[model samples]
Target: MPSHVAPTTAEVYRAHLADASTSSDVFAAGLAEEPAAALVNALAGLDDPPTVRLLVTETVAKWLRRDFHLASTAADLLAAETLSLRVADGSFANQMVVTADAVASILSTDEQTAGPATDDPEFVDSMRERCSEAWETAEPFDLRTPPRSRVYETLGDEIDPAVEADYQAMLDAVETTRSNGYRTTDDDRFDEVELVLLAGAKHELQHYDLSRWGEDVGLASKATFSRTKNRLEDQGLLTTEKVPIDIGRPRQRLVLDDRLRDVEAGDLPEAGRDVIDSATE
Candidate 1:
């Protein structure tokens, strides 16, 4: 579920899909109009991408490469998981939606998969009629998806290439440079909290998701993770803000401080540091 209260985001998205005529163009445009709806539709039968990404230990982005089959052997799905880690926000959601739409479109007219199995009695019956010659003469495609370099690169194959390229060029390349450029625990052997903060600073947006790093630091339990975070807050090393979504519970985003970006572990006074104050509350 996207949240505990609301239906999973995918359910809301599936509702929207009802109005959409299984067309890729409609989906592409719908994505532009309602990104959230697409986000919901993306994980489709799955749960909220954001919450799942934050909760799951480290599952691959099976939705990204449109590889829903958990037992897939295609390299694209593996590559998509790697890409998920690098892209900001929810790029994987888009990949899922696009791939599903494409598959639906292809399947609707496919012969082998369409025959008597479907009540329509049209299993790609038109495939030979439509592309027999084209199939024989068709050139082999590079067989690739868009890259992550730009929106066009991510969406080139799915949408009108010209439209994507036109919009892509106009996007401003703003650099989100923090004054605390090298914010880290400067050679200090840090406890879980300090280490988590350091790792967050290295992230693209500096937002820490516990599921992504909890096990690595031995803070797999949310209660412990929260306590550690609170300890860091007491030290003024991190700040947190909650983002409310329609589905699941609001997510608390952890922001590391730039001023104290690089604190030498040994330089700090180790006086009374073991107190935990309501980090999980």
Candidate 2:
């Protein structure tokens, strides 16, 4: 049963979906008007676009974990989709893609297995229709539900092309994975590694001046970050150099090895070449 405590972030979004005055255009415009708060609130009441939901839920959870207070967990159902949407729209930093893809894929599998096999026929039918629509459409899609409508009305207009494309890709991947019925821990690990590679790349590029780029990615803990950094260094995707950040104090700087860059930019390692291929691709 979905929790009803006050109104979760999802419920707030659901309310937006329920309104007749909302539209994607309105939501898009709201982004500039409100930024993070608007983005957060516009996320309310999304029931369709499972990919969108998955991304939103995951982003919300992460935001919450990082102390971005917006109450609710129903978005957990669609966390991955939201992140993908953010990535596509250019609203988020690029580092979130690998993390979004990996987690969203897992959620897609989980949702399929958790589907309503034991529910009332009417409800089952409703869910089935929603799922079908979700799989077929792009963002700002209608779930044939009031709450979804309100959300659309509120945030739909703001979606950019990148977000739209990435979201479509995410949906396609989710559908493909669901149809295959081949879930494995290896898939999850690949995603983890991919995220690590992405973070490492960002660190190497000096995207941020932080001492621990991998740890800042938010998907991995400090220990996991250390492990991934070591793995990549071993694989030659990264190299550590001692640099002077503070005049007296020296710090370790992550440098991207040209060979590794060639590998990532080249076709040397495809996404499914091996367990860790996903990281490179």
Candidate 3:
């Protein structure tokens, strides 16, 4: 007799989506917040992961996407329906439901232990029915980090090569902030446009023309950047100086306030959050 080998969690997920190019839907249930986040992040890391309609609990939907259509149900209802089983259905013919242990393994840095899976038609049908019911009441969620390609497309062909490196660095920093779990869509935190301005001002040190900076990042309009800049200035988180130009009117040079001047580049997101919290309190 041959020893049975277990498939890794990633392998399991990949197998479920193997036929996904033809279109697939995934119903993920009973995942704790961290593991749920890990699952989405892992999927996004795949070289050619398919875009699936992802059904999840409201709490887990906070982690948004570059791919995957998302819908979420009330946490309690989701918990009751799925219990400890973590389900991901690719299609009628391909379904997977794993134990709590297997779900936890998705977050493991090492080779993830695979949990037992069943493709029984009746079981898959029942699970799908439950998920469909949940979907009826689920809300569509659209809060997501913009994909890099979209951002560049918005920037277009006019970017000066001299400042191209700086722009790329800012984009990298924004990604880092997001990877560290800061979300631009969170109401209590600085939004995406505000983050770009803060990062540019803090790290680049050169006085960029505010309106042009907005155009360079392709995140928001010049007026939007101006408005956000004024708000942050009002909050004492940012300051600006007038710069004379031979062209039209003098441009405003964005600068971090004295309080944020000494903060490290990586700490900006958390630091920005803290300031916002303090201001609100």
Best model number under TM-score: 3
Worst 10 residues of 3 by lDDT: 67-76
Per-candidate alpha-carbon RMSD to the true structure: 20.6, 17.0, 9.7
Position 187, candidate 2: lDDT: 38
Model 2 misplacement above 4 A: 1-189, 206-217, 247-249, 263-281
- CA shift of 268, model 1, Å: 12
Ranking by TM-score: 3, 2, 1
> Over all chains combined, what TM-score does candidate 1 have?
0.24
Q: Write the per-residue lDDT of candidate 1 for residues 1-281, one digit (tens) a residue.
A: 11111234334344333433332222221122223223423433332122111111112222322311111212232234321211122222222122221212211122221101111224323322222332233332221222223323433443334423433322211111111212232322233234434344323122335433344322235565666666566656567778777997787766645543343332222211222212222
lDDT values for all models = 0.31, 0.32, 0.48
lDDT of 3 by residue, 226-278 (tens): 67677777776778778778998776677887778787665766677677677
Decoy 2 TM-score against native? 0.32
Give the local distance difference test score of model 3. 0.48
TM-score of candidate 3 on Cα atoms, chains taken together? 0.51
Tens digits of per-residue lDDT for model 2, 235-258 = 555676766665666655666556
TM-score per model over all chains: 0.24, 0.32, 0.51
Q: Clashes in each model (backbone N, CA, C under 3 Å)?
A: 10, 41, 0
